[model samples]
Target: MSQTVYQQHAYRSNQVPPQKPRPEKTLAQRLLSAGQRMLPWSRPTQTVSTRTAQVSPSQWQKMKTIAPNQECFWNEQTLEGLTGNIWARVYLIFSGLGKFVILYFTPIFIVTLLLTSLVTTGRFGLSDWIEALWAYFLYAIFPASIIWGQFEMYNRSYWKPKLLRKLLDAQKKFELNRRTGMVTLYKRGGKVRYSYPFVEFDCILATTPSQQGLVNYSLLLAHRYSGSMHGVPLGVLVTPHETVAEYYRLWNMIQCYMDVTQPLPDILLLEEARPKDPTTAAYDQQTGRNPRYWRDMSDDAYAEAITQIEAKQSKMSETGPEIDIFAKAS
Candidate 1:
């Protein structure tokens, strides 16, 4: 019986092993990978124009109508056709009062002087009435003239120029976003290169109190870490006006990953905050990079970067520059 059992065991030696199961990806990993498509450094990718951006003849016309002098240097012709809404009441108050005094009061003043003079037997003659009338009329005219002047000043100096600047800035920003589209990841080495769009990240970062500060901080962050992160490639998009702030936006993007999924090490932002580089040096010695001035970056990066900035904003700290409400004040 033992010899028979040993022979059976030798014949059963060719059994096949079961195959291992493939690993499944988590939602967080999938999202992070998807978001990388927005990064320019990811890889070369073709983009379809969104057609959301427009610089038509009508836009120029509207720009001109609102504030010609303040309109874009390249699109002055459009502004020439546009007209600003003058505060009619302000004009009325000044010009109307001035005309009324000159036309109606002049005769009354003269008549009162002549009548008073004829009736006066005292040293105080009608000359006093004439002099007083002239003084009162001049005083009234001066104030009215001032009010009119202020109205013109507001329209010319403040309203039109400010509006135009904002429009130009916005147009430039949008044009950039349109050109860049969404870059998620960039892989470049031998033959293959491609970009991926991560997530449609929309965050509002209000750094320090001023837009300038926000711009500075954001840009600095981008400059510090727009390259590879944890061996994974990265790219950034931002507004032209907010390149500086975009850097900070990247820092916050990393922050978002950390808070929600995995926190990046401090080196991602601070990066060994070494001693200040030489003033004459074009790039940092240790980091081997130049400062990424915000204005130099593309608009999509600038906008996205700022959107990711994490501001220490509070009601008490909102007293710096007035937010441009038309542009949603940042």
Candidate 2:
């Protein structure tokens, strides 16, 4: 966070993080960022994104504020895509089942055919027995056909590429590159359909109602002005909150991620990657923040930390520290 963002947090909370030098961007990056800002609908109210100004006990990581964390595979350079486990599980289940049927049932049927073919040469072999074997073969065709299809179509179409997609955690087909400041959407076969600056996306909060009279919140990173696309599924909030601030906090964390000027959002998952980011390492050095603050802590200490964060959540503003994410978009 910048000094202003920290000041806002310090006023309401006890912790005051020291400000560090902002990371320098290359001339090309500067020009690209500037071009993205010139886009019309990119900024309204200067796009103040409320951010949680903490290093440890990240709102999304420590608290169950979101599910299947969007930044599960993030780094100093890029954040690998994350989506629900449904598709990955789908790939695993179908692939495993197809392999089992082909290897196990296939050999059993082949051996049975060989044994039965030998029987045809014997007294049990003649006319009626041959007809019976043919009938059995007919009965086996459906599964045999499937096995043939698996051999014919395997890894060429349908499921193999989808498996690759889930392996990249890209069920949604988008890649966020922090170094390039670009969000690239992929076509079915990993083709780059389009690339836009991260600022071109508008972080939207969606409200969903369930049959049990409960409401759920999720985030979307939709294009600021385009309607051709439905945008990316940021992630869903699983933990219930007394207010909507937690959703905003989730958005803030994402903004913190893509904004190279700032450090990686301090979370347990990203702890190891912090030292890899020059800006983050510098910030940690200046603030004297423990490198393994969350990692080395005892499980009981973590539980107590969680209790403290929850207590603070009750007192947090309806929105967190309001800082203009699109401040450069003038």
- Say which candidate scores most in TM-score: 2
Which residue pairs of candidate 2 clash? none
* Poorest lDDT segment (10 consecutive residues) of candidate 1: 74-83
Q: In terms of TM-score, how similar is model 2 to the real structure?
A: 0.51
lDDT of 2 by residue, 1-330 (tens): 334322222111112133232346567645534312111211111122223223344443443333333244556766655445465566556656656655686677667766876866665545755676576556654555565555335333433444454463444467777666677776664677677766656665666667887876556676654443455655532344323555555665666666555667766657777887766788889999899888777666766776676566556543335444434432
* Best prediction by lDDT: 2
> So what's the TM-score on candidate 1?
0.21
Candidates in order: C-alpha RMSD to true structure: 25.9, 12.9
TM-score of each model, paired residue for residue: 0.21, 0.51
